[model samples]
Target: MIKAKSRPFLKHGKPERRPDLMNLTDSRIIGVYGAQWRGYLQYYLLAHNVWQLNRLQWVMLTSMLKTLAGKHRSTVSKMARTYQATTDTRHGPRVCFQTSVERAGRPPLVTRFGGIPLKRQKKAVLDDRPPAPMAGRRHSSELLARLHCGRCELCEQRADVHVHHISKLADLAASGQPQPQWTQLMVRKRRKTLIVCPTCHDHIHHQQPANTPT
Candidate 1:
């Protein structure tokens, strides 16, 4: 009334404010949505054996999703719950995860520190003693005495000049052939010839054709 000079036909003033009532409901939806999506992603990666991403990668991805959604706490809790549920079902009872030795009744056969078995030590001690000085022709003494280092007649080697049988005794016995007196003569006469380096002995046996006459 008092000269309200008709407010000069004001065009657009500030629009009226409207509160977003959907925010609360939208937060829950986002929580559930994030949980399902992240769970599926984790499961798929595990199934296909893709282990390239570390924990930090996963955290970064979830953090980004939560920031974009604008409801970080709710989404993280939902994702955690989903992860727990999936792990429990897919991986079996957590308590069952254990080392192989724990499952077996005996102590681990191997140890971090190298330790020889008692049986092996006993065998080694026995081996150190001379081979009962095999009687006749002083074969053991002759082997210990003569036989200077030289290239093996069969396989060339100057080291490890140990005794080697040209034909295995076991193989001869198994062949069902009667041992002739000449065979014994040959064994006794060739005692000097029997000695060769370990490498040469192995090579001689390896080169022999399997079906050759004994």
Candidate 2:
């Protein structure tokens, strides 16, 4: 059933010679295979028939190899031999195919296929979330990654960077009240939150006092 469902990614009686991927780089080709296979396994982690994915594994491995072979104008056996590598997992070292891309200022992205253990994972988290707004989720991820560059937006302080947030943009420019320097900065940047270091954050809070109970 899985094979039938995946027929579009395969060729008739020639799943090992995918000409469709001839234009992609080896890293992209290999990464796509790894991500798809991992996602499928994660989704079916609780199924009793989880071991059945080994069959899909062979199917995808062949297609990934053949796709690379087509790109390099080489034979499947040669491509397999070239990219074959051993990766260590909780289940021990497993043979897989790998591809890499080195960047000038960052670590290389090393992608692999077929190192995952085909074992039952009763406690694995399933990737079965219902669709919802992705904007907030994406914003959090971007913000977390931004923390590594820990430079405050105010005072140019590199230590103790933090954020100052307003509930809404309207709060930053309440009807007749004069905008504070912090509010002016947030308005200039057109953001509801301001990134600051420890000292600047204290100053901002001192100026923007909390409202008293009515």
Q: Identify the candidate with maximal lDDT.
A: 2
Q: For residues 1-214, write the lDDT of model 2, one tens digit per residue.
A: 6877367466665566555444434666787677777777778777888888887888888888887877666888999999999999998999988976554468877988888877787888766754332122244544553344465767765676787777677665663567777777767645666668899888877777465110
State the lDDT of candidate 1 residue by residue for 19-46, as single tens digits: 1111222222333333432333344342
Candidate 1 residue-wise lDDT at 25: 24
- The CA lDDT at 174 in model 2 is 61
Off by over 4 Å in 1: 1-136, 147-157, 165-170, 173-193, 205-214
For model 2, what is the alpha-carbon lDDT of residue 76?
A: 87
The estimated TM-scores of all candidates read 0.21, 0.57
Worst 10 residues of 2 by lDDT: 130-139
Per-residue error (Å), model 1, residue 109: 52
Candidate 2 regions off by >4 Å? 129-214
lDDT of each: 0.33, 0.70
Clashes of each: 0, 0
